[model samples]
Target: MRVFAQLFEAIDSSTKTSRKVAAMVDYFDRVSDEEKLFAVALLIGNKPKRPVATTSLREWASALAGIPSWLFEESYYAVGDLGETLTLLMPQQSRPEETPTLKAVFATMTALRKYSPMEQRETLYTFWTTLRGTALFLFNKMLTGSLRVGVSRKLVINALARHLDRDEATVAHQLMGKWDPLTTRFTDLFPQQGTALPHHIPYPFYLAYALDREPADLGDINNWLLEKKLDGIRGQLIRRNGELFIWSRGEDLLTDKFPEFGPLTTLLPDGTVIDGEIIPWKDGHPLPFARMQTRIGRKNLSAKMLQEVPLVMVCFDLLEYEGRDIRHEPLLIRRAQLAALIDNPALQRILLRSEEMAFPDWQAAADFRERARQFHCEGLMLKQWQSAYGVGRRKGDWWKWKADPFSIDAVMIYAQSGHGRRANLYTDYTFAVWDGDTLVPFAKAYSGLTDTEIKSLDRWIKQNTVEKFGPVRRVKPVHVFEIGFEGVQASNRHKSGVALRFPRMLRWRLDKTAAEANTKDDLLDLLRLYGQ
Candidate 1:
């Protein structure tokens, strides 16, 4: 346990990717077989390998070489993490006085090997029985890859520096060295100060925090820089010390996902990172989100997927340029620097040219977003020119001024039980539109209603069930709710040849009659924007 803690401390210090990887490989090479099993599980994080499904101890144990899921469930119910469970299961003397940190556990776990099914189950059970209180909670969070300490990866980098008495850049290098996160150790690969590390490019640092009310009035739309709110992944392209790193908003490295932008490496200003959105675009407009979904996580994509969902980098904000860190600079300053950095808009791949557009009023911005469906856009992004880069949440500096959703008062025709907390309640719903004389099922949306509303609806579903299709309960089409969506697209997969983007229930339209529900023509109008 102490050894694990020490390794985590070392991994914490490592900023360079090489150092982290080296540490992980070294640590994994040394642990005992029993310890190795738990270590591997820990490396994979405390979360179960997949979504929690119905399982018995014998069945699960058999699958994991005879280690029962009960063991893990017990440990998770106890200490929360498998490591702590191991600690609890071990003899008191074997349990180290000091608990190891998460990073140490990560390093220790990565160096280990695949455990037998039985040993894995035993380890899991022991882990649960031993872990307790806050430790258990943190362990559970780690299992889900969410340490939720309000800590960002950058903040972790800072923590590493503080732990190792090293500079940030040195530590950053150690951090970025490997692709396999499980095996990287931070301590052994810690870089010395002033090391010729990878140069990081300037990327926009996005900050969005929800406000109780509007943050700023914008005076008129004229003062704001408004651009279409694209429905795609946000990308941060960084070029530091000549090495290129492109990251998603979720901080996942995505350089390999879009090869078309790879050539832009030569044109990019070194030691810079810029923020942008990566969308599927061809010819002159944006592609559907489903198109880009095809090529997202593949290490090597099929040629069909590549041609089907080609990518475009829609550059938004610039954070770093040349050698200067412009995150501290105002948004207006960053815009000017970004403009000067990319001299050719015509050649740039789908850059969000908000500066050139006349945003002179919020209404104009809203109007543009309203018509954005024509351009296959989600909505609009309204940014304050004077704001500086701030991490996490909506600050006053930026706002996503998306158009109001495409709403329809629809009748709830079916209901199904939800998972986890709502496992007993019929919360999932299948909504329909009154087409001609029949209620044709057009969508199934389960979210957007409150727990109270769900409970009420749950009772109604049970009392009104006309028929049951396994877990799904067919209900009378008497309830009406307003459904909201980002965009509508035509699809042969459905009866209406219409699919809603980001569909969610806004409110129960009890005030509206079934006859007041949106017509099939409304769906057709929106789908026409997709050229179907």
Candidate 2:
């Protein structure tokens, strides 16, 4: 536990990637096999389930600190982090050279879930009193399931590859599957030493840069491939050895959830991997993203539900063919192969190609982006004709030029503190549209605001707060701001009878008041305008 805490401090203290990689390698060399596995899992977003509720933890912590609960709440609001607040409130104690191992400590936490809440609280109180400084903070963070430091997942993979003198892709593929920290050893992670991996594993996704300018800013239009930008979940469909696997861009195995794509196992030949977008389709048109949400997170799909919300994979690129990786090939070659395969009668219904549009000039591509909504696409995807498939973000070879977002005026209704650096400020907010004389909450936006703007709004929110619900404050809806989004849909869950995708504050409307905010009907009109 002490070594892990030191590792956390080392990671948190550095901002440079080189320093972070060195810190991870230094700690990796000092811990046991189980400790190394546990640390790897935590760093890569594989945290264990929190055994106790946060409210109970706050109460127990306050009692141990000999402070009132209200005082603790105020400190928490000021600190903007429960774990940090509790760690600071606890009196510093003597440090011990050795403590419990990371695995043993984690086992104690998981076992506490079987005990009564009172018993659990007592155990936590005793543990808090024993641990001090960085160790206490580590325990609090692990218990609350918020143990993220500055170190990123990519940095961890890079460090492992450099230490073992192995390829980065091989290290990433080994960490791709559902791994158990309790059973998997540190050496087990790299037994292959960068050799062949299991057939079901999906390759790392290739990303694009945002093109904020005209396509003509580059070179001749003939050197690029332009396709309509899809508004769906990016995924990869793997067909190997007569079995199929579907992996979301988030690295989730989704084959069972999307059984409609199961026919691909027999339709496509063995040893082929196709990359595409998983979209909600109806009558040959892409439906709103809300329709796609209905099919997500469900293992069992009824016949009626499946019929109501059908799915299709719009092929984007070909990653593998005939039991070999073809990512080294040119873009046009991969597209031609993918097109030929999708032309089959049995596979044509489930898989569709993203047909490239011909443009005589750059102005033609710019004009197409303006009318992207007409074809139910986000914008245009511009790729170089000879660019090879690569991992992660690489500039110049590919770009996504999305259409301007739909914007509307709305009022801030709720405010909450942010995490990390913004924890001391009420930077997160919920916006609302006018429904007759009352304000109805619709979308929550926390980004796209300048740091200066956030500071000003944070001060205003504290003064205008009319009611408080825990960390949330119901502020006076006097200020108006413009909200921008990509799409809108009807939702029974929201009070405004609407839901907006990727909502963010475009700009503050200092000239407008709450009365000038848009109406709920106006949003509904937008829903209609965007094929909601």
Candidate 3:
């Protein structure tokens, strides 16, 4: 535990990516088999279920320390972290000179496989209480899923192979399979050395970063492919041993959510891994994101919920197919193979593709993306035909070419105090545009405002409130600011010429004069540019 804690501290303190990767590699080189496995799991972010209640940590600390719940409540004020409070309460002993490797700890956790889920939870909680402050913080960070250490998964994978004296690619491929550090097979592979075996897990896609931009000069839309940015969950579909497993981009297993797609296992070739977006589809067209959101967290959805949000898996890329890795294959060729294999209409479709003639230049792609609002698509995706599925945002392989957000400069017409810390001050804002020289409010925004700005404006809003509308207080329209949005569409419900899509206050423009605020003409111009 102390060893893993030190590794975590090393990772946390390292600012450079190279340093962080080295720290992880060094830690992996030193831990036991079980601990190594657990460390790997922690690195890749696979943990058991979390407690249902926010106060569960406090309960664990209370029970472990033999202190009453009230005592914890009082101490919590002094030490904000539950684990920190427990560390302070526990009796001091000589710190162990030999810290167990990540492999050993993970092996221990996994070796107690006979324990029930409740027992496992209790055991984990007990283990957490025994750690020192730094170790405890590291464990909590890994458990909750954010390490904040800036190392990339690719770098870590490389470091692992370098330390183990194995092929990095082979090691990376092995890491993707089922992980259990304490297994006899795992222990045998690494031997019971200083470290057992490092935990191996798949990397999260959303967190991957791209290195560079595609040249603004790629002519011919055929050289690139544009995809609708579907407002659905991103997922990776993995097939092994005649069963299909659907994993959300958030790393949540969504296999049971859409049981209709269960038949896909038999249809798809062996060892196939596909990446694409998952949305609830019925008949032909797409369903609202709200419908899909409804089916998300429930362990077992009611039959009614499944029937309502019946899902469709849109296969986009064939990462691996039929015991063969095709991620290195050209996208167009892989796409052709994908179409031929998954002939089910429910599985594949030639998504609206841009004509080869239209996107001969960046301006054209930008124009098409700007007009994508008409087709209910978010933006475009640009891919190089020769690029490989190299992980960690390799340049040239892929690019998400999104249209710049729609924006307008408007005047702040009202403000109010936010809840919790800002309850005594006004931080929320109601903004307006110029309507024939008159200020008319169209939308209200609370987020995107900075803490310093919120507190400062909160004081002013309270002093300048001209009128009250229940919880909202109308204030003098003296501040002019810029707001950004994804898109704009006509809305009869709104008094303004248009309604903003995902409107967010970008920044304060105090230097600008109130007369410079957007006018009715400006709104009309934006509505026209919305390409409806």
Candidate 4:
């Protein structure tokens, strides 16, 4: 735990990726294989489940500290971090304690669930007293099941790859999918050379950069293949070794999540990997993104749900065809191959082709970008026809020209402390729009304000806070801001009767007043216009 704490501090404090990887490698060099595996898992958000609920821990901690629950809540609001707050409030030990190993601490968590309530309280009280500083903060994080640091899983994988002298992509593939650090050994995970990957696992996805200039700046429009930028999950549907596998961009295997696509294994031939969008489509057009979340949010789909959110994999590019790695082939060739694979009637419904658009010039492409909202798409994706499918985010091959977001003027109703670096600042805000004379909460956005703007807002929030509710503050509805959103949907769950998709602060519209802000009617008009 102390070693992990040291590594966490070193990694979290460092800004550069090289320094982060160095910190990980430095710790890995000293730790046992089991400890190293656990470190990887912890870094990648695979923390042990909470042995005891945070509510129980909090109640016990407040009682133990001889502090009122209200005082503890107030402290938590100020700190904005659950783990660090609890650690600070708890009484220290009488004598210094030996630091436990990472594996030992994790073992204690698994053992804690079986203990009686009183026993659990005693165990936790002792931990609070015994653990100190960064270890305590990290302990609290693990206990809460959100042990995140500054480093990414990619950095951890890169470090492991460098340490073991293995291919980075190979190491990344090895780390994918579910594995218990307690049972699955480091050697077992990364086997000796010549071990074949499980056929279902997907290759690294090829992402595109945003197009800042007109398409004409990139040369001829004939050299580009244009497709509607889908507001859907980036997915890889693989038909390999006579089995089908669906994977999200997050590397989560969604084979069971969307059981409707299980039949595609039989439809597409073996050794075919298609990179495309997983979208909820009913007729010819896509349903709203909020509608798609209905399917994605559930682990198990009911019969009614399956019918309600019928998703189609809009197949576009072919990575693997006929048991050969064809990613090096030009996208033009890949598209033709993908088209041929989905030509069958069986695949027509299950695997829809992401048909390319014919544009005479860049002007036509720009025109299409503005009208993307009609099709419920974000905007245009321009791919170089001759460019090979590059790994990760490469600049030359592809570009995404997203449409301008729908803007509205809304008043900030509430402000809350954010997590990570922004934890100390009141960055997150709940905004409201007019409803007759009342201000009804519509959306809560946390990003899009500049650092200078945020710092200035934070000072103002502290000075003008009208009331406090745990970590959130009900602020005076005096500031009006321009809020930008991708889409809107009618939702019975919200007071505004409509929900904004990807809502964020465009700018603090100092020019406007709360009285002149947008109304519920305005949001409803947007819902009718775009939430089809």
lDDT of 4 by residue, 318-404 (tens): 999998989889988998888887888877887888868888888887888898887678898889899887666768779999999
Candidate 2 lDDT score at position 356: 82
**In candidate 2, which residue ranges exceed 4 Å CA deviation?**
29-33, 91-98, 109-119
lDDT of 1 by residue, 318-361 (tens): 87777766777887889898877777754376354433456555
> Alpha-carbon error at 124 in model 2, in Å?
2.9
lDDT of 2: 0.85
lDDT of each: 0.61, 0.85, 0.64, 0.86
TM-score-sorted candidate list, best first: 4, 2, 1, 3
Give candidate 3's TM-score: 0.65
Clashing pairs for predicted structure model 2, backbone only: none
Q: Estimate each model's TM-score.
A: 0.67, 0.93, 0.65, 0.94
Better model by lDDT: candidate 2 vs candidate 3: 2
- Estimate the overall C-alpha local distance difference test score of candidate 1: 0.61
Model 4 off-target regions past 4 Å? 111-116, 298-305
Global lDDT of model 4: 0.86
**Clash count per candidate:** 70, 0, 26, 1
Better of 2 and 3 by TM-score: 2
How many angstroms is residue 133 displaced in model 3 relative to the true structure, after the best TM-score fit? 4.5
Candidate 4: how large is its RMSD?
2.1
